[model samples]
Target: MESTHHQFYELFEQLGLPSSEQEICDFIDRHPLPGDVKITQAPFWTEQQAALLKELLKQDADWAVVVDHLNVALHH
Candidate 1:
């Protein structure tokens, strides 16, 4: 089966966050995650956002790649 690809900004949009490149950069800068913390467990996320992120990762859905990218970005 062919995989569906999604952009990093689209992940933010789906989470009801600012989707602009600058905004995404700002968000990551503001909410840096500790090395041990998972992105979905970040305090900055709402319940729905966390749930969506968990679901995407659990299912390895189309948004999973972007979600992983965001996770790495936050930890840095």
Candidate 2:
């Protein structure tokens, strides 16, 4: 199902983030990852946040698709 907002927007909601267009955009701008890092490996996240993201990916839970979309957005 195509999302009404950006895929990353859905991921943020599922992740319990700000979930606003401007906020998510600002977040990405503020926390850019290095060329070799994965979103899950980004340094900005606390251990709990990282674990949550990892769990989403590992479980392929309801939010996995959106999380994967976010991963791509962050990686590139």
TM-score list, all predictions = 0.95, 0.73
RMSD per candidate (Å) reads: 0.8, 3.7
State the lDDT at 20 in candidate 2. Answer: 88
Candidate 2 overall lDDT versus native: 0.75
lDDT of 1 at 1: 100
Segments of candidate 1 deviating more than 4 angstroms: none
Per-residue C-alpha lDDT of model 2 across residues 1-76, encoded as one tens digit per residue: 7634336777677666898899998887777667788878888887877888999889776677777767766665
User: Which one is best on TM-score?
Assistant: 1
Tens-digit lDDT track of model 1 for 1-76: 9988999988999999999999999999999999999888999999999999999999988888899999999999
